[model samples]
Target: MDSVDLQVLAAARRWAAEGRRFAWVTVARTWGSAPRPPGSWLALRDDGRVEGSVSGGCVEDDLIARMRGNRLGGGQPFILAYGVTQEEAVRYGLPCGGTLELVVEPSPDPAQLEDLAARLGQHQLTQRQVDIASGTVTIAAAERGDALSWDGGRLITVHGPRWRLLIIGAGQVSRYLAHMALALDYEIIVCDPRKEYGPGWDVPGTRLVTTLPDDTLFALEPDARLAVVALTHDPKLDDMVLMEALKLPAFYIGAIGSRLNNAKRRDRLARYFDLSEQELARLRGPVGLAIGSRTPPEIALAILAEMTAVKNGVAVPLRDAVAEP
Candidate 1:
């Protein structure tokens, strides 16, 4: 789920806890040019209040008007489609006759909302299924590598931290990386056991863990949307975690070190941990795109850029593959 969906879910939970009635509108399908993507959510309160968005204000305005008029007060979950024509699409700000489909469920189940919110807060990917006809909800564990799908009478919505980053060190580079990652809506967790480096580790939207790196990786169980980078340059701190991260399904696993140091680390992993050639190949030794990153912030930028590219399944350019010496 994206930040918008998460925000809507959070607001829904708060409203439900306060004993307020509301509905959740989700943009599940779109054609041509839609303002919001699939999984985008809007929380509508009983008093015609809203927390999130599904379109470029026009659709929301219409929904709000309907809510105020009590037209949608009926406790029925149904699908809504708008902008079916070119003129209608243009009027609604959807370019080129785009059509958008929404699943509007009235008075969404409070328990289901809370359960999804709790799972998201715990950084676990969760699948929420809602039966339109029966108004029943089922929550299940989502497979890490699979995309969300909608089955007959059941809409599966994936909820969790959208992306995760586990920084193995709380140094200047880690600080820079954390800052950038937070802006990109990644849930960041920094691990550094050394007190000197761990102290004063304050970054908004990131969790700082002063636990052993290896233990942190074990606890995190890095997911497919997760990236782990070892920046401490300390074998005892970085190596063990890097080894563990390499074994996980994390999309990106890297270690910050010089070419020579990286070679040595690879040799050590192969010699001691019995890492196969394929596993070793997965480790981004030098870490980050080249981009002539000389300073900590610059290096962080390169690493984040590479991570973004990998997440989007884009091929990094050759220049970005190696840093300039």
Candidate 2:
């Protein structure tokens, strides 16, 4: 789930606490070109207020229209299948035969929802199993590798912090990266031990850690879901962290520098640290797409955009992979 889904989950709990009825919508399944993936959420209040989306925009509009007329979900949970036919697809503007199978849970147990929200915020992997036949909802701990599983009778969705990013420099680029990462539901930690760079680091929803980057890497115990980005542009600082991060399980280990600098850095790592080609292969330098970014914010955007592609298992071509150096 992204930040928007988290917002809806929190709002649903709040509405239930207020004794106000609302429909919690879930995109249970999707056909081709679905804008939102399965398990994406939207909270719809009794007064027709919405907090998320299952379609690009059309489906929500239709739901809102039904909600205003008092003709939507109420007494029991229900299923809504949008864009079933070609005519319906054309009318709803579902691109490339896109369709959405949604589940609306009205008046769910507030206590359970709140507990789930708290646990998810704490970065715990949680699985929600909902039995449509009995209206029984159960929450349990899930493994890191769990994916959304839905049968006709029951739906199980996994929720937790999907990615952890360790930005090894609390510089200007780091700030923009942290800000962008939050929207994608990544737990970001900005690390910089230098007094000049680490002190008074302020970015909402991101943690500031004043620890040496290499030590921070060890503390993180990085797994495949973690990404380490070094942006200090200082060899002493970035090199130390990359040395440790390269040996770890992080899926992305990148540093901000140029192609020539990267080549020199790689040779140094190979000669001094005895890093193998396989290990060096894991390092992404000239990180981000080749978008000709210059400003700090644009550079940060390019970095995260590349990270996003990598996270989604998208293979970026080498020609388009090196944004800078």
Candidate 3:
């Protein structure tokens, strides 16, 4: 689940606990170039209050109108389809004839919502299954590779922290990276053993560790859902982590520095660490794309962009885009 989805759950829990009449909407499926993906949630109160999005801004107007008029839900779960025809698509503001299928449930169980939110807050992956015939929601353990599974009868949505980012420095760039990654629903952890960097380090929704980068990297043993970025320019801190991280199954492994410095770092790793050619190829130096970024935030954006592409299995060319030191 995304942070936005978590927020929606929290809001829904609060509203239900307050005895407010509300409807829970989820993007059960989409066809063509949909604006929002499946499992995106929206909570709408009887008074037109909303908490999340289903199609960005395309299909909300009609939804709110119908829900406010008590057209969507009463005591039974139901489905709503938008943009069934080309003219309907245009009229409803769906882009490029996109279609949205939604699941609307009225007066959901507040205790269930609270349990789901708490599990996600603790970073546990959970699957939420809604049985349309019975209007029941079941919680189950979710596997790492599980996606939103919807048949005509049941809607199964996976929620929790699905991605982890391990940053090997507590510097300014790492700060920006951690901040930006949080919005993208990544669990961020920064590891720096230096006492100087540890004293005043603080970032909301992120964890900072004082262990050395090498030890930290080994302990994580980063899996396919993890991305490792080395922001410290020092070879001693960055190289040890790289030497270990490159051999792992992590989706992304990158080091931050000038191209010249990265090249030297690569050569040194090859000469000293006995990393194979294939292993060396797995490392992304001068991390991120060709964005002409100069500031820390801009650079962080570029790094995350590349990481996202790699995570989604998109082959975007780098073209040697690292910013010059």
Candidate 4:
């Protein structure tokens, strides 16, 4: 599944292929409270078609009007500010007197769009830098820490997955989780040393590693942007991952099992593996929310839901498997 930015880039490329005129808008900066964050993308076709969004309904409407009237960027790139004043904020439907500075490209280069899309399709984190004065764009490799930078004359936006998810098993649940996480713009890496499991793994957009779980964890060099999930349900495999993962700085770490199974796993880690209480506290086991999920897909959904909540800094109670009747 393509992210909203990738979808917007695809739409722009499609319009270019069909010989259509379109304007591309990026939320370069925001003040107070804005609907979208910096680097949000929106494409406006000449016929009022829209892909993605920069603000609530009102901002898109204004962009559509400007596009239809041939007044968006006046044949070049320009910065358009909305909701600067309290009254203007209400008029534009911006919340809390928020303001948005958007960079509009009257005629974005089709070649540039295609290049960026190709790089992202190859699972490369790329940056597209646009010179606001000339509409000239340059594409380059980007690091995970790179962020969107707007200096009033240049706008640089990072594209592709900034977050990473490492799954220790390539089973059905992991397949579903990896597939779903791709839509959220996460670079997925699935590790399974068991030869039997490697042959059946067919999920695209995820890299499968045959190395030991601990080796995979070591190679990844877990950071705040990384998340590790164990789904093998094998103590030897899952515990191997947690032994090293819980010691790292990954933002989220989880393992799939029932409540009793996770409890045992935690005890084993503490007693044998020497995982600290604080480190073990970071492990989210019986992973996912209490969504009463029975099937593999539902379980995957719950996992992603919980992961999203944690990533957003939302306080979610620990999820435990309910006792069976």
- The most accurate candidate by lDDT is 4
Model 1 steric clash pairs: 290-323
Query: lDDT per model, in order?
Result: 0.82, 0.84, 0.86, 0.88
Model 4, 206-310: lDDT tens per residue? 899999999999997777778999999899999998999999989899899888989999999999999999999999988888989888899899889989999
Question: Which regions in candidate 3 have their CA more than 4 angstroms from the true location?
Answer: 56-58, 218-221, 318-324
RMSD (CA, Å), each prediction: 2.8, 2.4, 2.2, 3.8
Rank list by lDDT? 4, 3, 2, 1
Instruction: Give a tens-digit lDDT track for model 3, residues 1-325.
Output: 5778777888888888788888888899999878778999999988888898987575888878987787876777888899999998888888889999998887677777888877877777899998899988888778878888899889999887558999988988898889999989898889998888977779998888988887887787567888999998989899989999988898899999888888898899999999999999988997888788889888898899999999889997643646563
User: Candidate 3 has which clashing residue pairs, if any?
Assistant: none
So what's the TM-score on candidate 3? 0.91
Candidate 2 versus truth, CA RMSD in Å, comes to 2.4
Give stretches of model 1 more than 4 Å off: 151-153, 258-264, 317-325
Candidate 4, residue 7: lDDT = 79
